[model samples]
Target chain A: MTASLIRILPDLARYAAKALTEKKLRSLLTIVGIAIGPMALTAILGVVQGYSNYVINQLEGLGQNLIILVPSANYDMSSSDIAFLRDLPGVKEVTPFYSLRAKAKQGVRDIDIAIYAVDLDVFFHALGKLRLEEGSLPPPGDTASAVIGHYIAFDETGTRYYRVGDVLTLTYYSFKRGRLIQHSISVIVAGVLAEFGNAFFVNPDVTVFLPLDAGPKLLGMKKWSGIIVVADSPAYVENLTKFLREVYGERANVISLIEISKVVASITAAMRFITIAAGSAAFAVAATGIAATMITSVMERTREIGVLKAIGFTDAEIVTSIILEAILMSLLGSAFGIAAGVAAAYALSTRGMVLQGMQVVIRAPPEITLPMIVKTIALTIVIGVLGSLLPAHRAARIPPAEALRYE
Target chain B: MTRDYRAVDGAESTLGQSPGQVPILELRDVHKVYKVGEVKVHALRGLSVRIMPGDFVAVMGPSGSGKSTFLNIAGLLDVPTRGKVFLLGRDVSRLNEVARARIRNRVIGFVFQQFNLIPRLTIYENIEMPLIPRGLPRRERKKLVLKALREAEGDTSWLPKKPLQLSGGQQQRVAIARAIVGRPRLILADEPTGALDRATAARIAALFIRLNREEKLTIVVVTHDPELAHCARKILMIRDGRIVGAEAPQPQRCIAYSRR
Candidate 1:
């Protein structure tokens, strides 16, 4: 039985090809309709995967053993709080940084930038090495010196606004003596960091770094905004985080990079579900189109089916031939869809999009895995087979005598 | 010759019987009734016929006289509403659809007025259709197709051409070739020459005569043309689903008819 079935495969294939080619316009339209669903699905999945990878990489770049502590409402981190964190078990280094949102002006251009004042040695140790494009780090005890991000030193068109040895003025806001006050100061740019395109949540590209002691005096504030804590090893991060949470209780929000990674993973999974659901809806529409096309084909080929049955073809053979035709169309459409989808994905990953006049670059390229290819092909086959079944059965049920008489 | 080819029910002797002097087809008390919406139409009432091997029979009737219905029953394409149909010594009136299809594929071949060639396939592939269901290998199928094409006097060059590319006569010839490719013992043609010009119709009639005489093939044709019916050895006139007359034309008339 197997051998007999194998013997008929080539003939079945030939018949399927002939049938599809006979109505070129109709077949092409059906294929394109089916392809749209998979194409859209693949493109969306590629973009989402690329973005997820980028976020994961950013999280990894901030050391896995690193944790951050932010003060809750109506609370602030003082020197004593910093000292308590420093003496905690498994703590390698604790760097408390003061962050203030400030508006800075260089020449005639003005932009909003985050100013972070940290102990240079501990900050560099907690985060990895910072890539500098020009000049050296600020000298020790140089309260007037500041290191600016790559975007801060240059305008959007790459024109230099402030370089090494240039002075920039920053305006800081504070509440002093129960009254709103504004202070302005000029600081020399000691160095410019290389461009890091949109990886970290708080992008260092658009921020200025100042000496640790200068923050309280310059901002006229005695409390720290946040503190960065590094565990001795990655294995100690969970324990250290728990200890910090217990000690601070409701006063502070202690978050580890690992916890952020878990949250990011869940967000990506939710996005994937939405994308698949959208793809399924499109697939359903495409399947209906396929069924409609097949029904029309069966109707048009009624006489031909009669001829086949009159000659020697059994009802099963007739059904098999029709189903094979649909399978062939689906396979062709899926091949085209996969190719177009992958191309779209590659283009999206390589060339970033501009949203509201800001350029967003994807740091990771989209990957097409074997499992993805298998899944797409499997989906195509299922749609093809299911869509053609009813029409095939209809063709099989056509009476040879009546079909022969059909005009 | 009078012979009883009917096998006892549930007997193994029903299968693989040698092709002896048994009649090729026999319909005993056949009836066909069609239900059209709320009305019942009696297409055939108590029709009975016997066709011996090597016999060329033509059935003639007006439209709606059930000539086509009778041919369909004989060809195993449809079953009688009530009766016994015996093909090659086996009673097959109550066979299931798949069993009937198997019998049709193995023992019978049919030709239609429209030629019924699959438009998409080339002449060679159209002829190869019957052999495919039998699981014949490609080389063997090609051999049989070539043989049938030569027997039908079809043009070998037309093998690569599609059905629509051929003339009406050539397409009919190809259809004949397809029917004979499986080497069935019986051929049932319904209005085989109805769509052809006079000359083409005469040519097809001569081809049928030649196949019946040279190969000893049993042929049953239904047609309205008396000239075509004259080519057959016996003519059966049907009206209102009943066989009203059966006659044999003079042998001299058959020869003279072919000469024309």
Candidate 2:
């Protein structure tokens, strides 16, 4: 056995090299299909992962282990409901919110804006995700107070129309209360938000802040859209959700950052399945490429097989040689494919984009796991074996006389 | 005579010495047939022939005359459909494929018409191929390969050159070296000079005759050329899968000459 191995090794190596060199372009093209899927998949998954991560981070940053309770299918808030929720057990904070489509009027200049009202004391503690870039929080008992995002404060002309202590008028319509509902309010824009994107602090891409207690009188609402609940600790998060669900009896929509993140993960997993389902076609094509090459190689070497048999090589040896050749080809090709995929991933990760006014960061690292590497190798081996079957069998079936007869 | 060229019938002369008369190959009514679907083609028809020690024999026939099949059977590369073939007086027909292969590798060397040298291998590696299954140490195999290359008497530099780089005559020499490298008792040449020019053919023929004379080796040459067959001491003519006629170059040389 050792003697046979010693004799066959050098001969097989020479055979493999000669086969590869004989058809350089065809070999290169064959490997291209193999590299595409992993490369595209890595880059796409990286970006999706990065974006999802950023959103989750922002949500968790609002408050740790916190829950937000809202109406089952509503999008508004009222002061009366806020007062009622404020007295509920396990509710650490309650704040009413009123947001309306309004236009800021500043001495013959107008900009679209969202007029948001809140209570000064409760807003300061319960404004979970309202971050300010360049302004202070509303003071205690400050009825005419407001703050804005960074982008809403500046215009393309570098003009600041609304700022702190600025009294600007806001417009609205009226809704009759049953027989006589009405709505009309022109409130002051006490503070302009900081810059966020391409809008001024008082622009429609902007938001105006007002006193929470004053929202019920202005918007004429009897119920609240949502209520914020801060747990005593992370341990109480599940209990709070259960308590809220039991009380609201399906009328309340409770969403937590953890839940949202889980949703994102499931969605990404589904997307991955779709991507792989689509990419499998490409892989199949690559496998076929390998099969075709192996078949051609077998046809070309029919005489060689005869010679080996004539020289005392068994049927097993002929089959093994062909299979070994296929495996070597796949291994070489897959290696180059993986390297190309990684290089492509890295190149696409940078150059972040904007989505929904949030920065979309792409994270394309090699980020390859051990299982993925193993899977790639295993897949290549399978393909190699499958590819060599026709060739190996053909070589094995050649009658010694007929094969030797081939020139 | 430099060496005794008598035949060895070891069964009669059991002196524990070769007696210089070893019947290296013996066939008793060997029959080989090939079946293609329902048609059975008889390639060898109850052929019985013996190759004695130190005898240079030639098998000449037309195409499809089954001479190649006879050679294959004699070399143990292929088995007969019926009949017993003995190598060194051991019945090889009963042996398995692997056992027969071992015998083929060790007891017999083959020289093909096309010079079947692997194009990628150098002359030295080509010669070394037959020695690989010998289970010999590397140093020993190397020594044998070099010695065979030296015996070929071609350019030693060609040892490192591939077959294509060498001429027809040189390639034939390499093939000869490869065949004789393992020092097999019997050498089978299947149209060894069919591809070479007349002059190169004569040289190869001279080499074979010299090997048989000097080493007392048994040789069987199969060819279609009548002139080539003339050089052998015994010429067997085959037609339609049977030995039609046989001639001994010197019948006057009696059985005494064959004995000693």
Top candidate, metric DockQ? 1
Cα lDDT of model 2 by residue, A21-135, tens digit = 6577876665565556554555555555555555555545545566777676644445565676667666677554555655655456665557666554555454344445544
Best by lDDT: 1
Clashing pairs in 1: none
Chain B only: TM-score of model 2: 0.87
Off by over 4 Å in 2: A1-11, A33-64, A72-225, A231-252, A347-366, B1-23, B52-55, B94-107, B120-145, B159-162, B181-185, B213-218, B249-260
Interface RMSD over true interface Cα atoms for each candidate: 1.4, 3.2
Docking class for model 2 is: acceptable
Question: Which candidate leads in TM-score?
Answer: 1
lDDT of 1 by residue, A165-230 (tens): 998889878887899888898889998988866655456778888888877776666888889888
What does candidate 2 score in Cα RMSD to the true structure? 7.2
Error of 2 at B65 (Å): 2.0
Note the DockQ of each predicted structure: 0.57, 0.23
